[model samples]
Target: MSSSLRVSPFSHAEEIDFIQLVKITLQRKKLVAAITVSAGLIAVACAFLITPTYEVSSVLRPAAINELDALNRSEVYKLPPGEALTKVGASLESYETRLGFFRANPGFFKEFEAPGRTLEQSFEEFNRNSISLILPDPRKADSLSAYIKLEMTYPKGVDGVSILNGLVNYAIDTEREQIASDMRVIIKNRLTEIAGKLDAARANYEVDKEAKIASLSELDNLRRAQLQDERKALRAQLKTLRTDRVAQLDEAIGIAKSLGIRKPSTPSLLGDSERSPSNSVMRTEINNQQIPLYFMGVEALEAERNALMKRKSDDFTEGRIAQIAKELQLLEANREIEVLKSREKEDLFLAGVQPLRAEEARLRNLSIDMAGVKLVTIDRPAQEPLTPFKPKRLLVVVIGIILGFIVGCALAFIWAFIRNRQSFYRTLPISSSGAGATSLDGEPPRIS
Candidate 1:
């Protein structure tokens, strides 16, 4: 039952007209051969007429970030080599650079362009056909160690080499300028920052100085008040001492008068006061001797008081002196802080700004002569290629022949099918009638 259900639809069909199809195909054999031969000839002519392309390449090794670190001795502002190369690659691959290339050397590139090609068209064509930047060892990509293969292609081997070299040089110069510009911009920004910091530092120093000055002024006020109080007390004591001295002198003179002492030969050198005794006079010599002795004691007391006054005049209040000394220390301390800030400013410039500036200046001053340092090393220079890299004549001809045969076969089959269609339709009625007569019931004939 499974076998009967699996019967093919063509089981009742007549045999295929293999001989007639072969004869019809043979009649078109010349056309098939002509198409195939023409295709082969065309392939050969194209292979010969097409301009051969050659690739001229150079390997470049960029400078390492570690080298910059060695020069700078710090990593505060170090730029990685990979990052730098990335910028260079971006510049090299940029559309603007390609346009610039064509614009700069119109005469050289005109040979590569069609007669009516605009600069934009020329640029696009050049980008597609002329230049390529290849990174060898993609898996081991390190900016410092990775090699850049700068390749160019042209019809002429010499032209390929020359153009490749020129492009590499141009890319190096442009990238160096770009890198230099980047460095200058960075340094300029840093300098601006430093300037702002310097201003802030100065402002802080000034504010602190003012506050300290104010503090010193308050201390000075306290010191002055203390000194004034001390001076006032000293003056009061001095006045009392003067009054006592005067009273003692007056008493001595009175005693001398009471005793009726003979006037000294000096005639009262202390300005004798000849006032009469307040009470009855004592005319005894013992009283006379006592008057002299009292005058001597008063004289000694006056001398001692004068000496004390002189000593007090020469001395200063210790508290006030101590406060002044402390003020000086405060001033000196502020001065030291300002000095330190100045030194720090200088250090920041040296450590942060100066190195980057120097690098910028060096890059800015760079000429084509120093391209080697700014750009990567040229490990392998472009050499004139000896042979063409594309359009292998034998391979192209083989492909053309294969396609031509396939097309020829398809055409032959189609023509053969068209010629056999009428014959096939005429036989179909007869076969259907025969099948109906041979069937027993109303069922269709069984497929063998």
Candidate 2:
């Protein structure tokens, strides 16, 4: 018994025949051509109808060293050209900065305003899509290759070039203002610190001066007390000496009257026994010693006693009394303490204050006009582009034609498949065993 191989028609359906596909496409040439032409015409119309978007780009480089020299020379705050460039770039990329710029110049972005969109929505769209910052890739860039590129896109009728240039300038100005404000704060803080130090120094100086004055006053008081004591003692001594001289002269007068002697008498004149050589030697020896007051005559003793009694002020008798009075007078004033108290400019005497004052003055007098300061160098300014950046007419039409051709080919194949399956069903015969339908020639139907 020979077994017949049964083949299913749908088995070949998964396989593609290019010739058959071509025939099917040719048969539907009108439909394909219609679709292709319609898509190309639509694309052309869209290309013309869509708004043209223009791109404006600008490059930012580090400022020249000379441009930043003034800032660095401030000594209070310093910023390098590269850092300034970085700051400006950061400002350009900042959303707040962009929004600020947008709000500041509403007329520039007036085209972005629409009926349904709020200003915030407009800005969001602008910030997300319209602005782009291109920085050098860190992995491929060197230190000296640092730069930033700013690109802006806008539709026709918008001044993209002016907007780009204005944005760059605004970012630079914002960064410059920030730098200047930071420097001013630093200077103000330093000035405040200097003022505090000066106040402290003055306080300390005042304390020291007061201490010195107190010490000098104490010392002068002690000196004055000593001088007063010495003066009192000298005056007492003079008074006692005068009283003793008066007593001695009175005693001498009594002795002279009792001895019946009227003149200053020596031992030899007193008696004949004292006239010997040995007595004369004794007299000479007695003269060498302090002589007795009775040896003076009554008249001379009385006159001396009278002068002693008449003496009122004995200051001339001792030179030390005059010196003590002079010293006491000097100590009463304390010239050194007086000088310290009368000083008008105490800052000059404080240590380390001259340099601080000079610095404070310099900082106070510091005036930096950031208006002329350049934060970044514009390598290339934004120029008006002659051509639009988007909606390329030829490319769009070409793509549309290609897509339409593909779609037309797909539809042609689908219609061909439907027609072939319907014809196969119409020609199919019923099987005797009631299993399935088969072709009239006892062969499986094939898909055309």
Candidate 3:
């Protein structure tokens, strides 16, 4: 026979120690309550200490007929509407632009002061706390749009409306002055370019006319010289021919005298000499043969000489040359007239530009008289706000109460965990058995 091992299912079913945990938490209730109440009260006090902020906002839109549009319409060139205003808005939005404005107006910094801090740091804080820009559409976000809203918040120490209005005026004037200056510069450059072109055209026209007249005059002089030379050569050849003919006639007369044939009607036909015509017949033949063809006799020569004289006189006459000169003069006059007309056109353009320049000058002083840019106020700053901007007292109190209860519960649970751990160690049992018996960590003996 052998002893068998017996196991009970109820041995593993220990009861939970919730009652002990409750007892430990109850023991530390006073400590948890003190911490919770102190935290809640401190949070409430801090909330009250924060200064309440007040807000004032204003809206602006482009004028129906702004100065920029009017200027563009009147001038030969056009500038986009609201361009200058948009640029001004951007500048006003810039950190540097604001800083510069603050620097210029040192009094503006009095309302915003952070002791022991540099001006720049104070200015940055002031901008963060006091200014905000509201864009209607995120997609079309630009200073160029007229639908931008500006909001300013300042402490009760300063007048928010006065400050905002003053800044708005400053922005408008600065932008107008800048645009006017640019317009003046553009007009000046255009005028300079036009004047240069006109002067160059006039110079070229004058030079061309003078060159053509000089060329034509030189050609006429060359033709006259050629005709004079030819006339001189013809007169010399006619004189030489007449002298040769006279010498031949005299030789024939001497031969007749030598033969002792005075007043002979004709030469006898000698058997030893060839027969020839008489001196009178030869003289008559000379007069009849080639003299008329070459010299045209004395009367004809005088008539030819007279004709040559007429030709020479006609050559010096200024009829055709005068006509050409008159034509050149007319052309030069027409060119001058054209130049004058072109100058008139330029002057007209400049005339249009002049008024614009004067308008620019006027705008430099930031006058509203000349149209360029205009700002219309949509909403003015509120004189008094209905409620404080932030730090709701009731909300702060509620948050503090809820946070205190949670913190109290957490402290109570932590106390329960520490107390239960100590009690559990105290209540643990120790076992004693025979040498051969196995401890709880060892294997149990087997039975068959």
Candidate 4:
């Protein structure tokens, strides 16, 4: 026979092989159909087993205009004192101080740390003892801490998300109000300090007034007494001089009278150009009147001298007293002015300070605001399911069917390769039986 298209020594009849292939399909039809049906049914089951989730959302706005203005005035403008409400720095500083203490002295951790025998134990203890939050807790899941990891997933298409967002917004607003509260305290403190200083200044002025007035009064009294004494002394001296002058004049008049030879002629009351006394008695009486005139002249001179002393003393006292009065008036005026200034600063201007009063005011305001927050609610979110979301059997089966088909094809190729190996002998360097040597087909030649 020709080399081309000739039958091989091991060749099988083509029709018979065709018949055998048909027989195989007919026999395995049930198995293939069963596998395909199982795969399809499993996929349908998997599709039905999935879980659905919902989402929520919300929005936030910045602080109100009036609130921002109040804060700006207190923190930036440095305006005079006013009644703008604000927050205190007490809590902020306290928080910082706590953080500092923890950072610098980690030993403080010893007392506060979770009690446990090992690091892992301690971590668990801390989670159980110290940690509290609104999210999924790890300790709640037994195997999650060891083998599985979890995360927080934000869901979509839900109302409760809005509630959470609103809560966050509210927390931010609270912080803003707290800032203002601190500003209020700072300003209030400044106002208080200024007020105290003003009060002290006023007190000093009052004390000064009392001392100055007391001294001035004593000095005035002393001056007045001295003037009186000087006037009395001058008057006494004048009176004594007048008496002596009168006596001396009387003696001279007597001597004159004793020497009289005849009575002096006297003018009558109607015509007083000349007068004479006809008897010794009338002449002596007229001469004695001249002694009274001499006494009058002496008394008048002494009175004039006393008046000058009194005038001089009064002039000195008035000048000194006036100076003291001027100084006192100036101090009083200054005190009044300072009081007015203090009032204006406290009543009209704003000082950014943190005060207890500011905190109280802020709390009251928050009370009003929190009432509004309560109205906002989370209506929709990822909810629990009527069906579980695990074990996707249908998809798993379809994948298994495809994998089985691929494996079947590989088995068919492997069978063909084995048959080819047996036919081809010397081309491939393989032995039927040897240590560390093997035939291409996974069969040992019978130990012939």
Give the top-scoring candidate (TM-score).
2
Model 2 C-alpha lDDT per residue in residues 1-448, reported as the tens digit of each score? 3234455546546666888779889999998998888888888888899999989899999989999888788787778888888899999999988988899999999998888998999999888889899998888845476789999999999998989999998898888888888988898899999999999999998898899999988998988998999999999998998888888889889998898767777666577444553543344433566767787878778888898889998899999999998998787687898899899988889977888899999999998888988888999999999889998888999998998888888888888877766566565554545645554554663322
By lDDT, the best candidate is 2
TM-scores for every candidate against the unseen true structure: 0.52, 0.82, 0.50, 0.39
User: lDDT per model, in order?
Assistant: 0.59, 0.85, 0.56, 0.40
Cα deviation of 273 in candidate 3 (Å)? Answer: 34
What total of clashing residue pairs does each candidate reach? Answer: 0, 0, 5, 41
For candidate 2, what is the TM-score? 0.82
- The best-first sequence of candidates by TM-score reads 2, 1, 3, 4
Per residue, candidate 1 scores C-alpha lDDT tens digits across 240-345 of 7656766665666456555543343123433334555333543323223333533444345445445545553322433444554555455444454455445544
Clashing pairs in 3: 67-371, 67-372, 67-373, 68-372, 68-373
Indicate the worst ten consecutive residues by lDDT in candidate 4.
Answer: 80-89
Choose 1 or 3, whichever is better by lDDT. 1
For 1-448, candidate 4 gives per-residue lDDT tens digits of 2121322323442433656544544555565556556655655656555443322222222223443344343342332112111111121123333243334444423433454455445334433433222322456765331111111122222233333333333433454455446555665675576556556655665566566656666665666566556555655665566556545645544543454312232223213323543334322224433332222333343444445434423323244445544554544334444444455334222233235346535434432232222211122323333332234445566676775554444445455445554654323343234432334444333221
Deviation (Å) of 180 in candidate 2: 1.2
Q: Report the Cα lDDT for candidate 4.
A: 0.40
User: Model 3's lDDT to the true fold?
Assistant: 0.56
Off by over 4 Å in 4: 1-67, 70-160, 250-254, 257-448
Please tell me which model should have the higher TM-score, number 1 or number 2. Answer: 2
